[model samples]
Target chain A: MNLQVVYCNHQTAELDIRERLAFATSDQLSNAYEYLRSHFPQTELVLLSTCNRVELYTAQESQDDAPSHQDIAHFFSDFHEIPLTDFFDDLLERTGPDAVRHLFQVVSSVDSMVLGEPQIVSQVKEAYRTATEYEACGPLTHALFQGAIRVSSRVRTETGLTEGRVSIASVAVGEFGKSIFDRFDDKTVLVIGAGEMAEETLRYLSNEGVRRINIVNRSPDRARALAERWPGAQVHAYEKLEELLVGADVIVSTTGSEKPIVSVGQFSRIRRNHLDKPVFILDLGAPRDFEPGIGQIDDGVFLYDIDDLETTCEQNRIARGTEVERALEIIDDETDRFMREIYHRATGPIVKRLREQWHDISQTEVRSLKSKLGHLGNDDLKAIERSMERLVNKLLHPPLEALKDEAREGTPHGLLDALKRLFHIKD
Target chain B: MVNVNVICFLASYSVVLIMELMRLLGRSPVRRTIMLLFGTAGFAAHTLYLMNRSNQANLPPLLSSSHDWLLVLAWISILMYLFLTTIDRNLAIGLFVIPLVLFLIAAAYFVSDSSMPVLNVSNLRDAQQAALRRWVMLHASLLVFGIAGVIVGLVLSLMYLVQHRRLKHKQTMQRGLRLPSLAVLSRWNWWAVIISVPLLTLGLATGFGVAFLSDEAVPVSMADPVIMIYGVAWAVMAAFFAWLLTTRRPAGKQVAWMTIWAFGFLLVTLVGLQVLAGSGLDSFHAGGTRDSSGLV
Candidate 1:
């Protein structure tokens, strides 16, 4: 059996290249699986697409049948309508033990942008499930994915990598929100958009006892939906955002608009209405939702944008990197151990078949000797059978030991072939 | 049983405070155990010392002389510290409380050690003298408890500030220095202010009542150094309490800082007045022998 992973991740590719090559939707992923199955009919396929990386993991009974790095890149190029020349150099490939180790690292979040994030494991599980639903996974793919999940769980339990603030929302609230307000229950939380970042931030705030949550989005239905999901939260149209801002103690803006949603003048008016109560504004938008000057309005107004949280997240990332290394080491060791076990399991049947055939030949020879020499009694014949069996076992021990030892590195295919030929053992 | 002295407990607490400070550097289970043992030993010694003083004075520690009175206040604070620290081994209360205990004991050195004249329950005692003694005990007890509350307020405010800073910086709780949540600390601070102010007002009122009841002796006048300074400290705390209650949006940090300033002023004035009064200053004398009545 063979396992392989061909992909480019945050480590190997720039963000722009990854974004261009990424399968961003479930439809795209399903189509990619179709293309993979069409190209390599015998190979099992599971495609993992996240913001940080895009990896295609495939397994097969023979290495030759497994899709190559070029095949996967061409599939991406054809599926996404991107030129092969654009990302061909950025693509990286791992096979055999390396591929298994890479998958283990990915599932364990060792390969994630935020080390120890729990989201990646679930994402991997979803990818595997999707592949299975598409009839793309076989026994090798199933076992590999299951092993990856188990390894991820073990790594999380055994290491301290998951102990601290490992998410953007957690860092934002912890670093900025707590600095602005003493208690969240007494504060009004205004979520500006219904994006995932907003949802994540709201989740953290709600956990901190924020009773009053207001969602203001351009899409009122989405806003209403998000607000309805969380208890005690209310949804408002985007037009009432300024009025909501006046009452909010914490404002989290993550709208996808290209320009600033709230300007200094608008916030200044809101600040006047609210008096000098400290308001924590977390602008999680890319192009900046709240104007830069809003942060400078007064001492009571504290504004933290994506860039500010980025610095803190980076610091935390650095601080936790040592633990990440430790976790990665654990994954590496476990991957090697798992691969060795799989190799041993693969070689087991052939080894058993060879041993049985040799033993049968020895038994027949012992019977012929006992029958030809009538001087031997029943006890003596039994003694000869035991002696012949011991000779056959001793003679077979060296090559079997060598094959098992070679299995540690990988499947000892060459040695097994030689054993089958020499022992005249049929498949 | 070996007789535990003030020095034995004072030294033990001092060592414990130092050990608590060491936790800021790093955590060690051995160090924590040692700190707990020393704290318990100090508390035992403090209790023994108060018991001895109460026994000698033939009065409750709160009704004894100003020296023993202040020690009683310190003893109460130490009890609170020990109770809280024992329950939450991670609390850094010892760092804030032990110093106050040390200051109380240190301030005791300058105050009068002579027991206040006991109120005679027998018929031979003068009505006015008995009345004066009872009023004095009441005044001292109220003031002790009031000051104890102030000490608690001060510590809670300090804790609020520390917790606020840590939360603001997004630092994880240090291994041995767990603090109360902001909500809990704020609630406790509010209670401390609410309770302390009334007790302090009563203590002041009782002081005035005692002065008025004693007609034969010159009453404690407003001009008296101790009385004047204490009044000023009370006014400061009263103003702080007013702001605390009146302001709808005062930050916890602001409240904490105000409490620190006001309570800190009261402590300094209370201790300073006692020390100044002990120097036999004629400016503080009311009607009794300057050597006999002042401070003690």
Candidate 2:
């Protein structure tokens, strides 16, 4: 048997190439699976396509029949309508153990651009499911994907790789926003400006059951666009910032202004009546839309700018980095276990036939001896049969032991062939 | 019966507290499980010790003596701690809770382990003893439960302060010491103060009732130093409770501080007076027929 993977990822290819090569939708992936199945009739295939990587894994029962690197490269060229020269150098290939290890790392998220990310596992699962739906998966791909899923689980629970939030928006909303409020469904979320960071923070808050969202921007069009994405969100005029701030339980500011938008003097005047109410402020702007001193005004205001989150994100990154070695060790151990199983699988049939041929020959000879000797007693015949069996086992033990040992490193194709020829075995 | 003593559980609790402190360095599931194992073993030993005392005196642990009362309070706190930590492995509640439990157990060491004098029904006629026993049970039970509430309030207040400081500084939560959200902590703290003050007040009222009832049978004086100190502590707690209820909207940090002061003062005063009473200071509540077991 043979295993191979030809792919390009964030590390090997630019975004331009990855995007062009990606099967962006299920329909596209189905079409690609159909095309690959028609071209390579004897191979099993699973295609894993995400924003950061595009990998095609194939397995075959015979090494001679497996598609070569050039064949897969040509398939990508013909299927995606891109010339082979455009990405031939960018497309990398791995065979056997390297192929298995690559899939394990990808499924475990060790190969993600954002290290310790959780999405790649689900992406790989979806790819495998799609391959199964298309009937492109056989025993080899099934075992490979199942083993990859198990390895991902082991890496996640055994290591602290996914323990902390590393992104600014995630840290701001997940760590700080959640610590201040018990629940967000009743709290008013105020977005000061329609920046990308604001939208991202809103996404996290929305997931946390936030229902009431108020978007205020100097530009009405941008604010409306932001408000339209959420079902219950409303766009407010920039003039109503102070009124909104008083009502908001959570405030996220990500304006592009060069200086502070809400000054201490202005906020203190507004915060006079709401001193007891807690407000989580995420000032994602570079210059900080909310003044720094407002945080010190009262215990109710939790103001965190980009620098604060960067420190947390950096710490989380370092923590995740430390777990990478442990994760790789797990992956390597799983990879070796998987290769060992596949190699032993290849030697199974030959070993079974060799043993069966020798035992059948011994049984037939023992029966012939009993029939030829008319004076032979029942005990004598039984003793002769036991001796014949022991002789056959003694003769077959050495080569069988060598075959078992050779199977540990990989499939011993040459030795299997020599055994078949020597024993006059068929198939 | 198995011989159980205060040292058995005290040593167990001390080890559990140290293990909880180790979480400041890093989180490990194995460490957490081990901490819980120690905490559970301590709670079991505490239960056995209390049962032995109750068996020796032939009374409930609460009504037996000051030492038994303090141990009952610690037992309740450890029960709460084990329940909370078991349900949520991430809560660093033990860091705030276990030390207070240890303090209560240690306070048991310095207080009188002999049964309360007013509860000594052995000398009275059977009819009068029955009547006195009911009054003492009410007084001791009310006081034990009320003190447990105060301990809970103190732990909640300390947790609120730590969580508030972490949020105010924008520091990431330690992985092992995950606390409740500030809103949840504040809400629970408010309830703790609200519920505990009323209980403590009723407990004081019941104490006065017991003293008045016992005047004819035994000269249970109202001017005992322990009683005087308890009355003063109750007064402080009542004032804080009133402020907490009547104020329009108090800051969370301010409430946390007030709870800490109110509850902290009451605990210290109660434990201090008991220690003084055990040292042979003049108090009707302390001295009685001492049990020979020395299990408290």
Candidate 3:
């Protein structure tokens, strides 16, 4: 049995390179599968495409026909209309046991951009289902994907890998925002900047059912563009910040300012319009756009800076680190077990043939002995037959034991061939 | 039948408090369940003890004696604590509220355990006794409810300050130690102080009103130093409550600290007066000695 994986992830390649290599949708993946079938018809494949990773896993019955690193890399180039030399260096290759271990790590979230994230397992599961839908997977890929999912579950159960909020946006919204407000849909979410970080956080908040999102930035065009991405979002001018502040229930600020933009006095004046209403201010800016004293101004104001989320993120990262080591240990054990099973399966036919051939020889000897000892008692004849069977087993024990031992590391192809010639075995 | 006492329930509440402290380190449903169990057991024993006191004294727990009255207040606080805790699973309210319950119960030990002379058959027949009992009931009920408000205000302010500190300082929440939002706590604190101060003032005013309506034979004095001290405490609280309500842009930290100081003084003054007056054996809150008391 031959298995292989060729992939690039957050660690091996940049985001642009991965995006260029990724299959964006199911149709793309399906077309890629059709292309793969035409090129390497003997191989079974599963394609895993996520924001951070693009991996192709393949398995083949015949080792000789297994797709090589260059072949799969060229397939990607031809399919995407990209030159091979552009990303060939970024593309990595793993085969046999390493490939299996890689898949296990990926599924377990040890290979993710955010270590110990729980999304990768579902991504892999979806990929496997898609492969099955496209008829790209077989028994080997099925067993592998199933085993990887099981390992992911075991890792989640046995470890603290998936415990805390891992991402900055997730930590901000989940750990801080949920604590501030019991519900989000009723609250007005004022996103104070239109940068990528702001957009990312807005995505998290929007997912929390934030119905009213007002994007306010120094640049109105950028604000409008950002607001257009989230559902039911409205864009406002930067000068209307105070009006929006009084109106908003939640504020997410991701301005890249060097100094404080909102002062304590400025907020104090803004708060006069809405004294009792609680406002959650997320200061995700570097050097903090909102002054620290603004949080101190009133009980209705709950202001959080990036440092708050970092502490939580750091603790989560540490927790995930310990779980990662544990997950790796589980992966190692599973990979070894999978390889051993495959090797043991490869040794099956040879062991069966050898056993059958020896049993035939023993039966023939027993028949001859029985014919020669026709005058002997029936009980004596049976005892003599048992002795002949024991003799044949003893004679065949050493070579069969050697063959079984050789199959532990991998399929004992050389030993099986030698045994077939020495025993006059066919097929 | 097993007899339950103050110590029985006080010990139970202490266990609940310890479990609440343990919850600050991390969340454990088992710990919360055990705390609830201890709280329920304690509240049950507390209820039985109050009933026993009332039975022995032939009066309600609030009118029996200062000791019983304080226990009744604690009992009310415990009920609130348990009810709030039952409703909000993630709230670390017990940590903030149980210490007050324990304080009231502990202070009961230092105060008078004596039942008043109002429970006597002879006093029950006296016309003056009926008038005095109404006044005393009004006085005690107003004080109990007012002090309940004070306890709530103090707790809400403390919660507000804690939540404010966590938010302003940008600290991640401690596992299992989550308070309500600052807005909720501040609003609750505002209402608590607003409603409770009036109840307390009415209690003090009624104390004087009762004294004025009584005949000279009762030997009660409105001008007594203890009563004057209570008047002073009431005035101080009245001023603080006025400042709290009138101020439009009260800073959260400022409000939290003021509530702490003002409510802290009110509680200390109220409890100190009871302890001191009860020690002297002649104050209105203390009507009889432990030797003359049926409930003790």
Each model's TM-score, in the order given?
Answer: 0.60, 0.89, 0.64
Mark the 10 consecutive residues where model 2 chain B has the least summed lDDT.
Answer: B287-296
* Ranking of predictions according to lDDT: 2, 3, 1
**What residue pairs clash in candidate 2, if any at all?**
none
Backbone clash pairs for candidate 1 read: none
Best-matching candidate per lDDT? 2
lDDT of 3 by residue, A1-427 (tens): 8899999888888888888898997778878988999999999999999999889999987888899999999999999999998899989999989999999999988888788887888889999999999899887898889999998988776665676787788988887787666678899988898888888888888888889888889988998888778879998878898888888888999987789889889999998767767788889999899998888776677787888788888987876676677779989999989888887877788789888988988888888977887898989878988888888889888988887788778778888889899888898
lDDT of 3 by residue, B1-296 (tens): 35777778989999999999997555556788999999999999999988988887778788888888888889999999999999987788998889999999888877777665433335244676777778878988998999999899899888877776676666766656778766567677888988999999899888776666453535576666667778887888888888877888575667778889988887888777777766784565555443323223
Candidate 3: CAPRI quality band = incorrect
Ranking by TM-score: 2, 3, 1
What DockQ was computed for model 1? 0.08
Instruction: Write the residue-wise lDDT of candidate 1 on B70-181 in tens digits.
Output: 7788889888988887787667898888889999987876776655333322333476776777887788878888999999999999988887666554455453566776
> By the lDDT metric, which is better: model 1 or model 3?
3
Native-structure RMSD, model 3: 9.5
- Output the worst ten-in-a-row residue range by lDDT, candidate 3 chain A: A157-166
TM-score of 1: 0.60
